[model samples]
Target: MENKHPYSELGYKIFFKIKPFLKKILRIKVVGVENIPLEGGCIIAANHRSHFDPPVINIVSPRPVIFLAKKELFEVPVLGWFIKKAGTIPVRRDSRDTAVIKKSISLLKEGFVIGIFPEGSRARPGEFRKPQPGVGYLIEKAKVPVIPVLIEGTDKVLPVNSKFPKLFKYNIDVIVGKPIKFEGISSYEHIAEKVMHEIRKLKGERHG
Candidate 1:
């Protein structure tokens, strides 16, 4: 069957082209990749520590992921062009944007995978920010499986205030946890907490 999902072939191609270079420059170790389902719509809810989080997840994902990016990134020049072409959805961080919610639901129905950082923004390394309710809303609305992921060591490569990454100097670890599906409960906050709990477990950290 012809693909109906909105994954950009050009984006996947670009990712593959740059994958080798990224790998050569940074030591990235991916664990429990099998936890990611091979097909269908799923949400990858992860912790964010650095700007590199998105690309790292995209590169390691078994399938193409449509990221929910902060709206500001979409206003930049070349970065904007790439993200738009890659079929990323822009979200305004200051409020709960219904338009983004609707768009995400529509995409999920079309069998697209979405990568979301529930913490909403980058937090200090080894610490997690409280997850936003949007993630739970998406899970409840779309009724898709969620995979909790923990990313480590990216902060060292690109610290919070640094503009450029320290090339070839850091080892990054991405740990993928088993999928969590909400069978009946629909409270957005509760669901978000559950997802965050799983991520914390993977990171070997206490719940926030």
Candidate 2:
């Protein structure tokens, strides 16, 4: 079957080429990977703590997952170029831009995996931010299953204010929860809150 995702084959090719190196450097351990559906549209909602979060998820996912990045990141030099070529969707943080949302919904309908950070931006280590309503809105509109994920130790790999990422010494763990399909009518904020609740449950289990 023809791939419906907007990302070029070259992106996946490049990823395959370097995935081994990334796996070795990041030392990522994955759990509940089977929770991820083998095919069809779904949202991989995870907490954000580092710029490496997106790549880390992509490295572990069975299918290519596209992410939404801040519009400002696209203007950066090398990082911006790489993300753009990787087919990330840029979203304006300050204003209400429907284009990005529409594009995301379209992608979901196309049966592609879309990755999102409910908190919207990176938080300090051990800190949890309230999720933005955008993720909830997307779920309501797209009516797709959401795979809640919990990621740990990425912040240590690239702590805030550090110019470069640590090549080693940090072990990253990603826990993928069961897919959730919301059925009732609810506000976007409520949906986002519910998703975050699921993510937190994963954290609680990890520590319990």
Best TM-score among the predictions, by candidate number: 2
Task: For residues 125-172, write the lDDT of model 1, one tens digit per residue.
Answer: 889999998888888888888999999989999899888898788898
* Residues 83-153 of candidate 2: C-alpha lDDT, one tens digit per residue: 87777999999987799989999998889999999999998897879999878888898888899999999
Off by over 4 Å in 2: 1-4, 206-208
lDDT of 1 at 40: 84
lDDT of each: 0.86, 0.88
Q: Model 1, stretches more than 4 Å misplaced?
A: 1-7, 17-21, 184-186, 205-208
TM-score of 2: 0.93
Alpha-carbon lDDT of model 1 = 0.86
What's each prediction's TM-score? 0.90, 0.93
Task: In angstroms, give how far residue 59 of model 2 lies from its true place.
Answer: 0.4
User: Cα lDDT of model 2 overall?
Assistant: 0.88
